[model samples]
Target chain A: MLSKISFLSLMGPLRSVDIYQSLWLIIEGMVGILIVMLLIYLVVIWVNKIMNKIEMSIDKNR
Target chain B: MGSFSFITQALGEITLPMVIMWVIGILLIWLALAKDFEPALLLPMGFGAILVNIPHTGVLGDNGILQWLYHAGIEASEALPLLLFVGIGAMIDFGPLLSNPKMLFFGGAAQFGIFVTVLISVLLGFELKDALSIGVIGAADGPTAILVSQKLASNYKGAITVAAYSYMALVPIIQPFAIKLVTTEQERKIRMKYNPQGVSKTIKIIFPIAVTLIAGMIAPDSVGLVGMLMFGNLIRECGKLDSLSETAQGPLANIITIFLGITISFQMQARQFLSWGTVIAIFLGLFAFIFDTIGGVVVAKLMNIFLPEDKKINPMIGGAGISAFPMSARVIQKMALKEDCQNHIIMHAVGANVAGQIGSVVAGGIILSIAHGFGL
Candidate 1:
């Protein structure tokens, strides 16, 4: 039972071996690149909000 | 039996291979000193190579200083490059990236070459792990390449490190050619406007910490590399540790760089360093860089299709996405100015260039994790 459970858990990580492992790696690489792009996009949006707020505060003071 | 016989014996040991290695070492030194190419690293590496290759020196043999340095710093643990990241982090200012966040996508896009090279290398008959190490040279990041090669392909570490640093130094020459090949004359002339905005000190302090936590959580194996780098940036941003930041960026960085360069030469012994595999690895490294340039430009061109006219990015700035940092950025700027004398794209190029730095590290971490998962 324990071995079966472990095997099931391994499925997601093991997805990197679907076809030839190298080909899987290429797919994994693309996914990783996309994740980084998403993170950057989110961070940029958040920073823009903060900067806009700060600009507004500075304008009020002036 | 005589002293004369001892001199003759020493001369006899100098084979054609040793002579060839010596000549290569001399050329490296010449490139560093005369051609002004990456002198900080190549000079030490070149001198170390000559020192080790001299007959009977045994500098790369058991109990030798170079061997000890290699074992202590590089072979024993992956500490040197990770520690060097701290200094690198301290030197970086994330302001440009923050001001122009869209440039971060270029960083992600630029990593296209790393994956492409992995597939090509496998097709060429390299094992998956070895191919991954070779592919990482596309990251355009010397430390990350060294880290990956040391972990995954220790056999080819010397060739990969030399190729990584050599190509990094050659970015000024290589990137322009790659850029010219893919880009139109009109695309190169597109001017990007730089809006100077002030990023608050509080956000600057928060940025490194946030990146460290987020990147570490996403890729656990990358914690050491990304964490140390963010720590260095934190020291610079915190405003309370100016002296520490200075030391981290200056003396600490210099000492590690010198040790790292000379120690790497221990692997450059003629027997292992001079091989068909090494030659292929060097050429593949160049191919990876070319692919990275294409990836960045293609992504930018793709994005242009959706955006309004004035806000569109200059596609040439896409080439700056490689992790050569300011050098790649400067090349794009120079090319742009040459095409249209009034155009200034340095700020936008720098934003993408810095993003490439972080993007490369993240990609390296992801690759490391995937390689580990396969138990390679």
Candidate 2:
């Protein structure tokens, strides 16, 4: 009985990789990475823009 | 009579396994010296293996020098790899990453291979813990592989470390094969504009701290690994500690690396290393790297669909997302130059490459926490 339960548990994660499930997991992971990448992209752009703005204001004051 | 007896005893103690291990060790030494493949580590490892396997050497026994070093660095508490991380952290210049943080995504994307490999290993009848350790070879960071395997699959630690470091050294060869399979000449020639800008000093110092805090909060298990790495980076960026930074990157790193390499060979006794499982672990490690390359390239290709005409990445830069560091990034740049001499993607690739360093550690931590949660 314990062996049977253990076998079932082992099969649990495997089911998610049967065929379509594998594709979904790949897509999900890819999307998560993409989201993180996009966020980093946006933050960098925003920060650069703000820095440029501050530089321009300082130049104007001079 | 006593001297003759000692010689005879030594000769009599030689076994088939010891001979085989000695041969393997010699081969490792040849590869290190002749081929110049990770000589600093492999040479010491090979010599240590040879020394330990000699009959009646007692080099790997409880009070042996090798045993003492292994316990002090590896067995005692995982101090060796963490110390090496500080050196690695000191050497890394996050300016490129800061300039183009979008490359950070490729780091995350490349880690997909780790999970995919784990799933495959589990399906192939490996225990979940063992599979996780084998899969982490995809992290492409030698220390992370060592840390994970030591904790989860101590028995296979030698094989796992060998696989991880060997593949890392072969990044220049492996990455190109994978990149060519997925990318076209036109995509490879896609030249990214280089715009070098000076980042403020304050940002450089803050970057390591912020990353450590964020990563720690999200994956608490990774704090030790990430924290030590960030601490090294902090020493580098602090500006007032140039001498300390140099020490961390130079002597400190080299010394730890030598110790770590030699100590690891203590586990490479032939009886333990020569097995079907070792072969499988090696092949799985290669597959992990291949998948990591695929993951990076595929994600880059996917992103190109949404990006505008001018903003489309070369797609090959995605291959740089594995934690082989500057080597992977350099391979991408060389391929781009081969495609078109005018093309320059080194900076972008470096950004992605550095991001991979952090991504790999975080991924290792996440895997550790998940394995713990599973009660494995």
Candidate 3:
């Protein structure tokens, strides 16, 4: 963690926050999107699978 | 004696890295010619690979021939990929996706790889910008990856480019495992009917233009990629411009593809590209690609619940959501065939494939904007 902080400091500050702060924000944002997107996608796929099973049963009965 | 000694000294300047580059160069030629993965790209890439590897060839020596071509064709203007897009656009048919627009989600879902790769890259100690640039490999869109790499100025250009194309070639192998892992045998057998007749020619023509305008408005950063891609499609779908479209889809595309492939390989020499970072980048890239498949398929299945009785889609096409183009779509078709041979899901798969192409560019643009916003 100390080395990571020093590495960020060496990169110099171009944005509003310090380099370490900015790197943290960027990583946080990316992870947020990745997790949220995966959750949404998985939920959708599971729901679809359940519905398909019900639909198949109905069609067979008809 | 002095003159002879000077000449020998000049010969000694050739580096061992350059020798290794020569071997890799020959391998690319063999892969292109004998294996025939993508002959158009591999051949020129192989040739360029050889040219650049020669110790004192002066091609990339200082300001030599290959460098001139690289600068003029690729690096200077970034014209080749965009120009090639016109041909690709002209060659595509949007009828399938138009008939079933829900597959658009698949395209959007497949882009999960890029973001996932970025996260893993950061974990492995890569900087945010470089990781983002490298993650575009999972996008499965070569031009998009190049566009982002050039914009970000990531130091790992050669490895990034190879990772993008190599994963593309490996699609046939990678996608099946992904599809099967996420989907059960019962889910694989799910059938849905799609008819191309539902899509009118007017709609086909309008689809590309409308998507370009809407997508551009949403993500202005993607104008170059989305605009060029749509422009190609416009030429393809338009009733007129047969000659223009033909040129775009034919020699123009073939020539550009050759240059693009070779130039990428030229960047892949062992000296510049062989590093621990290279290994990490490839591993992270494969992670992105696999996740994208999961994301897309899962999204498609989720969308199925909202549909009325007859409208449920085969979830297999979800895997086709990545921007691997026709290859991902073909994989979907094969998976469906395995379950039920007569099930013709190619149309649905293609719809998702093309949509994935657009979705990837949009995601690439969004990443660029995010990076820019953070002032990185």
Candidate 4:
């Protein structure tokens, strides 16, 4: 009886992953990855431009 | 017969496995205290291991202080781990990562460990949600692991926390083997030179906000951790808030670590922690970390293929992509310097390290959302 109850509880949560759900998850993961990549690129570019401006300012002072 | 009975009475309570556990506990303590292998965490963990196995110690009993700390600090509201992040944020310098932003990619790639471990856990008979939560332990960041575990599988919180911390301290030992196995001697000795010019104060201050804004929108669940992390970095880079940053980096961080480490230890009592599941989980967590390193290094090597001539990256910094932060970065730099004393990969590695922190948090948030979506 104890084993039966435990088995029921475990099996109760089993959900079949259909095509739509799998697609949705894949799209979600891709979107997350894309956003991370874009943000990283923007930060690198912004930092580079700012550093260049600073270098120019320093050169003018010299 | 009476004298023999007394000896038998005393010896009857001691079990062989229990004795072995105690010896392991003592060895862990020795490693932490004598050998200084992450004494900050291992010492408390070791002492907790000893206390929990004291046969009749009430410290882990229903009304004991250790149990109370577990309830108050960990389970009740997840206070200690989140608060520890505030300290970690304060101590971190974002300048290196901010200057060479490309290192962020390495960080994201390193999180391959968390997912790989999740798949492995599933194979080990854990459900999808529980497996993902358990796998997050490999990200090498405790708070992120705790946050994900609480959200997904609070039942196994104690085991998960212990595994996360133990594996993180083992990085120095674990990573060298992984690094040596993957890379040829010639690759380990490969040198690349690029120095990021000094970053302006304005850009440095703005970088964290931009990251928070970008990452927050993408992975909303991670906002609290990622936001505060960037906020701490913002204060550090802002230059005017020097004193505030110093306080966050020092006393505030140390005090919080004290609370976090001890509170985490409270959950390590033998009754809850000595199961076969716990042992398997530790090794599996290490597997996640190893795969994360492999994923990062491989991607880095792949990236080198597309780089414009003269800009090829040395792949060693890929190991820094794990969320161990300065520790991972320092290890990568040490390895690099061994090959060439003048080589400096710290900046690039720091960038990857910080990126890994953000990536791990985002991954945690995603896992939380997925679990929530499934109503798990």
| Each prediction's RMSD to truth | 5.6, 3.6, 8.0, 5.5
For TM-score, candidate 1 versus 4, the one ahead is 1
Give per-residue CA lDDT, model 2, range B1-376, as digits (tens): 2455865888998998898889888988998889887887788888888888887677777778888887888877889988999999999998998887778888888888887887677666566777788888999998899888877754678888888888888998999999999988888989788775567676688777777776666667778788889899999999999999999999999999999999888778777787787788888999999999999999999999999998899899888999998899999999999889988899999999999998898788777766676675
Return whichever of 2 and 4 wins on lDDT: 2
To one decimal, what is the Cα RMSD in angstroms of model 3 from the true structure? 8.0
All candidates: DockQ:
0.20, 0.24, 0.05, 0.20
Q: What is the lDDT of candidate 1?
A: 0.83
> Could you tell which candidate, 2 or 3, scores higher by DockQ?
2
TM-score, chain B, predicted structure 2: 0.97
What Cα-based lDDT does every candidate model obtain? 0.83, 0.82, 0.72, 0.72
User: Model 4 Cα displacement at B361 (Å)?
Assistant: 2.5
TM-scores for every candidate against the unseen true structure: 0.91, 0.90, 0.82, 0.83
Residues forming the 10-long window of minimal summed lDDT in candidate 4 chain B: B1-10
TM-score, candidate 4, is 0.83
Candidate 1 residue-wise lDDT, B86-200, digit = tens: 9999999988987777888898889889998987776676667778899999999888998888888556777888788889989988888888888889877776778755677
lDDT of 3 by residue, B1-376 (tens): 2456756764686777776666766776787678765556656666776676665656665577667666776777677777877777788776666666666667777887687777666655677787788778988887788778867777787777767776887888888888787887877888888755355566667666666665566557767777888898888788798888888889889888877776665466556676777777777778878888887778777877897767777888888878888988998898899899988888889988987877787777767766787676
Number of the top-ranking candidate, with TM-score as the measure: 1
At residue B364, candidate 4 shows an lDDT of 76
Interface RMSD for each of the candidates: 8.6, 4.9, 8.5, 4.4
